[model samples]
Structure formats: structure tokens, C-alpha cells
Target: MARARICKPCLWTALLGIGFLFIWYFKVLALGYYWLSTTVNAAQWEGSSLWLPGYQVAVEARPIEGLTRNTSGLTFNNETGTLFTVINRPPQIAELTTDGRLLRVIELEGARDPEGITYVQGDTYVISDEHSDSMYWVRIGPDTRHVSIAARSSLGIRIDSVHNSSFEGVSWDSEQNRLFVVKEKLPLRVLVIKGLDVFSESRGFNIDISEWKSSSAASLFMSDLSSLTLHEPTGHLLLLSDESALVVEYAPDGQPIGMLPLWRGFNGLQRKVPQPEGLAVGPDSALYVLSEPNLFYRFERIQKPAVAAN
Candidate 1:
């Protein structure tokens, strides 16, 4: 009987093809897993039942020029009663008074898309560029402006890893001495730094954002949360979504407390605010909302419930 003949060359080629297929399958799976994990961790705060009901007091149309198109980050200084917003397409930080007057504008050229802004102390502020994980500390003086590197870590609160996308919002808790940074969209998480005192000690530190909690993930209702601001007096977080035309207020525990909706009259002015991006609370408790390009809205909080008028 003739011994069974085996095709040695064909067998080797088939084995090589199988090995390549396994490699390709794993490559795609690894990429997909990384994306899925990042998204889940980024938006981990969704489905939180903790939130308050926000009321729509008023919606002022786009009140400024220059801001009509690409507003990214927003912050309010209670001490000065000023609102700061970053217009990314041209990279300009525009300042406005509580009465909706454009006070000043600072150009930030070489900076990546500045997505978040917060006033730390006198003349010192921190800005985050969503395109990169680097954060900048800028010093504004009476006459000259200087920029320095403050914190340079991808230490996002809700992101699963530092390799994910950039950050969007920043809120400083002076009383608690913590910094809260928000990641845009899915698995919305807030990065909390426990001991902010040490932020200056070392360059920066990374905290697992998955551990920090939010009352609600604004992305569930409004998918694109462009910016966030914490109201110290009320412990409420104001979220702005450039795509939803709505601003929502959430409790620290992630509850859906209240919300404010934009009006349609803005279209009549040829300046419709399809995207309400940045948010800041004025000293008077008035909310300042800014949209892309150059549009600003002011909303005074509705009167709180009276206690029997006693």
C-alpha cells in the first residue's frame, strides 16, 4: 500500500494564513475594546437617579459679537461679577460683565482647543484644551498677560485611562479643596483630586475617575456636555450642551434636578444658538450661558420658596 502523501508546502501556507487571521482578529478586537472601555468609563455617571428640578427663568439672546460661532469653555468670578468664555475656532477668551457687556478679549494663539476655564485666585486662572491633555495656568495683570504651565496630566475624573479624549469642563471646590473636571459624552465621569494642596507640590497626580461619583450623567439627556460649573451656594452643577439647546442643573450625587431651555426667537436675529456651550454663575446667582461663535444668555434664578413669610 502506498503511504499517504501530505502536501507540505500547502500545509505550511494554510498555517501561515490562520496565524495572520488570528492576529487581525485580535487587533480589531483590541481597538474596539479600548474604545468601548473608554466610553463606558467616561460616561459611567449616567443613570444616576440623584438630581434636582431646574427652572427656566429667562433666555437672553446672543448678546455679544465674536462669540456667535464656537464657544467652548466658560467660568464666572463671583468676586468680580465677570463671565469668561473661550471661543476656540479663533482661540479668544472673551470677558463680559453681568449686564451683558463685552469688557475685554484675550487672544490665545498656540494653545490647543481651550475647552474649560476656571478662576483659581486673584489674577490666576486654569484653562484646559480638549484637543490635548495639557492644562494651562494664565496670569492676567492690569496691562500684560502671562501664561504658564499649571497642571499637565491626563488625570481626568471619569475617563478610564489617560489615553482617551481631552477634557471639557473644570470646577474648583474652594471649601472642599477639590477640583472637578468633566469628560464630554458617554459614561460621564468627574475627575476629583483629593488633596489639591499638593497640586503645586508635584506637577500633578492621577486619580481613578471611575471611583468619583456624579448625581447624574447629563449625556443621557443631552449627549454633548460642552461645559460645567458648580454653584457653591446651592451645591448644584450647571451643565451646558452645545447640541441640545438646553442647560441642566444636577445635584452632586448625579440627580436630574432642573433644566432651562433656549427659545426660538434667536433664529430671527440671524443668530440661532443651536449650541449652548459654556456656563458660569454670576455673583448675584444669575446664570450666564454662552454659545459658539459669539452669543451670551443671562438667566436670573427664580425666587426660592418662602417659608410662611414669618
Candidate 2:
């Protein structure tokens, strides 16, 4: 009997094709994993049981011409009764009226990427730098128009350096005497800080930091934590995202109880918010948001109809 004839060229070609397929499959899997892990909306599919109430957009995205093009974080100052926002390009803070009119501008020194700001108490405020994991304690008064490097001091949280994963949002709970700082992803962690003497002149003080986690909570369908606002009356937090164009409300225990989409048609918006970088709740419980390239947004609650007499 004759031995079976073998085609060597065909065998080599088949083996090479199989090897290429194996490598291609792994490359696709690795890319999918990276995208899923980095995207915020991907986390929302992980099964959460919390219910969230949506909000109505009172004022859609409007343009402001006389301000910095890159607005990052927003904080409502009850003292001045005005909204404060920061610009990352020149590292300056600008005060704006409720109608998006620019009031004042104060340049900041010794800060890189000032992304988040929260009014702590009195004239003291907390500001976060995105590039550096540094939080600054700054005091602004009637006589103050600019924040020099000498007047600014780091709060010293001692977080490990991660590129662009630094603090992005900040909220102050005056009643609890705690500061809630939101990290801009990788895990989307909220840092609850207590016992950090923010109003002191000394640079040395101990801070107690704890991660806020909820058992049955709704996921924040946000790409990055751009800003946060603490609603005192409801004891809830409004978290802002730049990429996802969303604002998620979280209860005191970190449970997401409400949400408001910045995109059009979802929240009565005629146009979608381009880039929401900062958010704040005014004294009257009005939601104020700042978008990149100088845009302002306002959201108000919808009042239900009164019940008829029985």
C-alpha cells in the first residue's frame, strides 16, 4: 500500500491562519475589557436595585461670552450670594450671577488643573487639583480678589498618584462637618473626610478619610466625576459627569436616589449640554451647572398638581 501523500504548503498555511486567529481573538478581548472598565455607563449594567427620580431642566445650556472658555468646578457662595467657577487654563476663579453674567475674576497661583471647589464655611473654601492629588484650603474675603500661593495651603490627603484620576468634585456637609470628595474614576470612589482643620493657618493637621459605599445603590452612569453639589434640605448629593453628561443624586448613605440627564429630550432640554464640568445647588435649592466653553444650566423641581377637595 502506498503511503498517504501530504501537501506541506497547505498544512503550513492552515497553521499560520490558526495562529493569527488566536492572537486576534485575544486582542479584541483585551480592548473590550479596557473599554468596559473605563466607561461609567458600563458600570450601570452591573445590577443595582435602587430607584432614582429624575429632574426637570429649568434652563438648558446657554452660552456666556465674557468668561473663560474652560469652566471646571462650581460652588455657591451664600455669603456673596453668587456662583463661583474655576478655569483650568489660567487657573483662575470667576464669580457669576444667576443669569450667567460674569461678576469677578480671581487668578490662582501655584495650582495646576483646579477642577473642583466647595465652600466650606465663612470665607474658607476647598479646591481640588486634578493633575496633582492636592486639595487647597483657600480663604476669600471682601478685600480678597486673588489667591496667591502664599495664602493657599494643601490639605494633605496623601492619596497615591494616578494620572488624571485625581479629585474632581467636592461637597461640604456643614451639619456633619465632613467633606465629600469625588475621584474621577478607575473606581469612582467618594472620599468622606472628617477632622481636617480647614480654617487653620498651620499646615499640619490629621485627616480621617473613609470611602463612602452604599449596599443597594444605583450606579452613576458617568464617565468622570466633574463636580458635585450637596443639597442641604434633602440631604442628597448631585454628582456631575463630563463625558456621560449626567448628574446623579445620592442620599446621605451614598445611595443614588435621583438623577438628571444633561442630554437633550431626556430632561426637557432643547439642546444637549456639551461638557458639564461643574455643579452647585443654590440657596433656594436650585441646581446650577457649568459647562465647558462657557455654558450655564439651571434645573428646577416640578411641582405636582394640588388634590381636589373631597
Candidate 3:
């Protein structure tokens, strides 16, 4: 009878706590952050910055040919003027035109859950395996139909990584020769790697990795990180969130500056991009986004000075 008295109170408290967390995670907190972050950044946004508010979707939810599922992280190959994305289900690297057309599929051998891929100058690229927390440097030539990584060309960072929440995206800064990586969730993280000479013939390693911490990131409003792309011109970083259905842009100094929401009716999107997994910027500065199960979208700059709030 003494224990039964506390049980009812404890159960009520537990139920209340669970309800609050669910609301916070799924809706309330995200809405609050979106309003607050975008409002604050809009005041400080510069015209010269990579203002994502000026973009509107040109092509929305176009299905990529031959891809049934798992069209993941994206990167623009400036050398070839094409885009590349990974499919972890079958472990393949697919080349694509700037539009939603598939060019070729390069088989990726020995990749474990390859979720993120970035072009690193020439025909070289880096692929991040979410399950393994590892990155492999591989080459893709014109005649190449397959890529197999050697043990020496791979680097792993296994620091308290969980299975699906690790290594979601990567982008290379050609000007600085540095690589930036983003984790999916569970304390979302962005790590920068430098001094990694992927083309160096020397087997010895000389790399320094550090976390890219921001005041905004510490209070990151996104439900989860999905992919990221670095705009080479302004050196700004764009972080994509699938659950939030948004892309938050940060200045080089790590200040949140602008956002591009992938929500329907906003950004001129006819339909909401379902599960955005890949993000890239083309040579002409058009934004390219890829969603899972093979949906491709392109957003071009409109003359809008205000964000498309939904």
C-alpha cells in the first residue's frame, strides 16, 4: 500500500516528461528555432553573402532514372562539369548531369554504408562510410567503371560514433585544402580535417582534425543533419536537415546567416522534398539537391530579398 501510493505519481510524471520531449523534438523546439534563428540572422545577413533566400526551386521532385532508392550525398565535379552522388544500398557512385538525368554508375567496392561523398580536385574524391566512420580516397576516371580503395588510402575516425547518426556529409575546401564532415544527430557535429594530402605518394600521414564549433551549432535547431555543401565563392557552409526540411547557411566565421527551406509552397517547390540527402552548388551557382529514393531538385536564384517563410 505504501509503494502503490508513489506508483501513480511516478507514472504521471513519467508520462508528462515523455510527452514534453516528443513535442520538443518533433515540433515546438524546431518551430521556435526556425523563427528565432532565421529572424536573428536575417537582421545580420549581408547582401554579399551566399544568401539562400534568393533561390527558388526550378525543378522539383524529378525522379532520377535507374535509381530505386538510397541516392545519398552529392558533390559537383568542376573538372567534368557533372554531379556525383552515392547509393549505399548497392554501393555505387553515380554521375549525373546538372539536371535530374543520370550519366553513369560507378560501382564502389568495399564501402560500408557510404553516405557522404565530395570531390577533391582532379578526378579524386572522398567517400565517408557512416557505419565505419571512415573516409576513403578514390579516383574516378572517364573509362573507370569501378573504384576499389587500398588500405593505405583510408582514414577512420571512431569517436563515440553511433550507427546511422555518423558521417552523413563531407565537403572539401579547395582554397584551404581542408575537408569538412557532418554527423547526422545525437549531438550533431561538424569536424574539419586539414593537412591530409590525399594525392601524396608518401604513405606517412600528416593530418589534423578539429571540431567546427559555432554558437548556432551549439544551439542547432535542426532535428537532424542530412547533408552539407560548401559554396567555394563565399566560403560559406550550407547544412541540410531532412527532418527539419531546411538548409541553414553559415558564414565563414561560423555565424548563422541565411536559410533555404525545402518545405512545400515555399521556395517555389510544388511538393516537399522527401528526405533530402544530397546538396551541391553548380558552376553557374545554381543549387542542386537530391532526396532519397531518387528525387532530384534544382533551385536557382530569384530576385527575392526576403526568406520564404512557411
Candidate 4:
């Protein structure tokens, strides 16, 4: 008997069907990989605690020292009374004396465009890549400084993906034991991560960002919000924006109370503060603001002109 032969139409149809199946299989695989990566990153993020609406306060501008251009976030050490500011482009954290002097510069590792800086338990916490969500913790010691990789999840917050969440401002509430983070713009809101102490104990915490809820009170500065700091003594929240020449103060309930314009000149000195990014309140109730390209301002509360002494 002659060997059976496949028909031409059947052969062509079989080949086409196989090709289509292969294409569909690869397409699904590619999508699955992309989704897996996203899920993994999201699983790594941790959420924050203590959500509150924020408002703005008026600030008087006095000059200070040590901050270079691109200073982003600011935090005050109630224990030491020192102000911490993070310089992005160059990725340097500077400690300033309340008197407007540059005291020390803490060099950071793997800090790609750091924007927020806060001090927790004597260690410096820095948030990097405002456009891309990533965080780092640099421990500054009296003898030697050490750098470590930190995950938002470590603090019980989840990050859905590295590309989804970009954190611009960060502040630690020692009293409440929480970390507050702010996104740059509209839907402009702050996130509170709880169980910070638990993560600090573990030294490696991962939080899911999907669980984070936006603060009903916090609003972005007119342009880009560079940083935010909490006033320990007063429970006030301060917000800074580079585009707007102003710093705002908000209450815990997110009610705007006052506004501070960057003073052009004061004390008979001509001061130009361009791109004010970082803000910190000192123990003496003085406000410290840092601008890009290297400039610091100290605003001392002057008792509202003493009511002209009656």
C-alpha cells in the first residue's frame, strides 16, 4: 500500500495553528512576568500609622548655613535640637546649628536623588528617588557612619510597585511612634505608617502600600512638595514647595492655620532663597528653611512684634 500523504490545505492550516498558539503562549508569559514583578514590589512595601489632616502656618525667614542647592527634606532632633536637611542632586545630609552654621555632612550610599530626611533613634532616615519609590537608612555614628537598605514594608506599609509610589516628604513622630510620608502632587496627601517601633526592632521591615490611606487634611504646595517635618512640641506639620516661595503650617487635623513667605531680605541683609525645599523647627521655636544652590534661612518667632508693648 502506498504511504498516506497529508493534503496541502491541511498541512498549511496545521502550521498556522501552531504558530498562532506559540505567539499566544509567549504573550501570556510576558504579561505574567510583568505582573509578577509588580506584585513582588507591592508586597514589599509597608504602611504607616497616625493619619491627620494638615494645615499651613505663616513663617518669617531668617538665614542659616551649610545647606547646598537642592536641599529637600528637613527634620528636627528634639533631643539634640539639631536640624537635618537632605540635599538631593548630590545626595548629602547636613546638620545645621540653630545659629546658622553647617556642623556636619553625613554622606549617604546608594542615594539616588534623595528627597526626605528624618532622624529616628539617633539614626538618619532618608528617602530616595522622589520620582521612583525607594528608601534608605543611613546610621550616623560618632566614630563611623553606616548605610543600610530599608523597605517601606519594614514599617508595615506596602509598596505596590517601585514605579507606583514616589515619596517626597518624610517625618518621624517619636511620641506617636509613626512615620509620615507625602506624595508630591494633587490627590496631594500624606500617609501614616503604624507599628514603626516594631519594624525598628526587626531592623528589616516590609510594608504594603496598597493599605495606605491619604490624609484628608494634607495638600501639596503650589508646585512640587519637597519635604515635610513634624513639630514635636506643638504637633504642627510643616510643608515646603520649591516652586512656591512659601512654607505652610498645618494642624494635626489638616486645618491650614498660617503661611510664611520666603523673606527677600531681613536684618539689613539681602537674601535670595530660590527653590526652598527643606524645613525644620528648632527647639527655640525658630523655623529653618533650606533652598537649592546652597542657602539656609532661620526664622525666629519674634513674639509678633510684642504688640508694640501697648
Q: Pick the candidate with the highest lDDT.
A: 3
TM-scores of the candidates are: 0.67, 0.77, 0.89, 0.63
Candidate 4 structure quality by residue, lDDT tens digits, 68-97:
366667777766767777766666777766
**41 Cα displacement, candidate 3 (Å):** 5.6
TM-score of 3: 0.89
Question: lDDT per model, in order?
Answer: 0.59, 0.72, 0.84, 0.56
Instruction: Report the Cα lDDT for residue 82, model 3.
Output: 89
Q: How many residue pairs collide in each prediction?
A: 39, 0, 0, 60
Runs in model 1 deviating more than 4 A are 1-59, 66-69, 146-165, 198-219, 263-272, 304-310
Q: Which of 3 and 4 is the better model by lDDT?
A: 3
If the candidates were sorted by their lDDT against the true structure, best first, what order would they fall in?
Answer: 3, 2, 1, 4
TM-score of 4: 0.63
Q: Could you give candidate 3's per-residue lDDT for residues 70-181 as a string of tens digits?
A: 9899999888888999999999999999888989999998987999999988888999999789988998988889888656387888866886888889999988889999
lDDT of 1 by residue, 1-310 (tens): 8998999999999999999688556645643453354335433322231121222335456457534567767787755667777767767777777656777778776666777888777766777777666556666554533343443323323244343344787877676766677777554555665555423535565433333454322223554567777766556667776665656666566654454555454312233455676777766556677766566676653443211100
* Whole-model lDDT, model 1: 0.59
